[model samples]
Target: MTLDCFCGGVRVTTVKKPEFLHACNCDLCRKSGARWGYFDPSEAAIDGQTSSYRRHDKPEPAVDVHFCPKCGSTTHFRLTERAASTFGDTMMGVNMALSDQADLVGVELRYPDGMAWSGEGAFGYTRESRILGPDG
Candidate 1:
């Protein structure tokens, strides 16, 4: 599936469905309004140019959030250099909200407690997870 920015200036194509989607309340995810779907860099392809932002609040921010320069819509994010060195380039996040709602059927949506995450391990859920139905 391909997800495009609001202006269609940037596109992210995924070869397979995400294992799950995260509705996180982390400062960055919340403020950016991104519903994240994870993928390996090799599993997806990104096209077009984008501006990116990396949080300075944390001593070592993890991802560099990218957005379409033409429309300011969040597109996708990659691990920062520091983070990549530690975690490798195995995962990235694509903004699932950019895709057609119909494309998300049967996908699991999880509410992770990103705010409480210590940045070293798996996240706990803040709310129960749900599977998207056809109606979405």
Candidate 2:
């Protein structure tokens, strides 16, 4: 599967289906203004100019996040422990906002309630779709 950014500045091709898909309520995650989906890193075939940023509270040893250098659009992320696990090492968290084909992904949106979320996550879609239909 190929995930392309809405601006066409970033693209990620992966061979494995995402292990799980959910939205986060972390401050930075919300501020980034993206809907979230995660995948196994081994399944990802990444190419393009990207830079990684890390969080101070990452549970894993290292959480490398990839983003488009040009537009500063976050694309994906990888965790250190997940990278060494036999169960398809490496985990990638994708920014749903970057995807142009979000609806086709069949992503089951989630709203993490533990932390403070800026705007509604997948809930926004439900409201929007109700008002504008799937075309929205």
Lowest summed lDDT window (length 10), candidate 1: 127-136
Give RMSD to native, each candidate: 0.9, 6.1
Candidate 1 Cα RMSD after full superposition onto the native fold (Å) = 0.9
Clashes (backbone N, CA, C under 3 Å), per candidate, total: 0, 3
Give stretches of model 1 more than 4 Å off: none
lDDT of 1 by residue, 58-122 (tens): 89999999999899999899999888998898899999999888999999999999999998879
- Would you estimate the TM-scores of all the predictions? 0.96, 0.65
What's the lDDT for residue 128 in model 2?
16
Q: What digit string (tens of lDDT, one per residue) describes model 2 on residues 1-136?
A: 7777656677887664443445555666676766656666566666777888776664543457678888778788776555456335545677756545544354445556525433334333212111112442
Candidate 2 overall Cα lDDT vs. reference? 0.60
- Candidate 2 residue pairs in clash (backbone atoms < 3 Å): 41-90, 82-90, 83-90
lDDT of each: 0.93, 0.60
Candidate number with greatest lDDT: 1
Residue 72 accuracy (lDDT) in model 1: 94
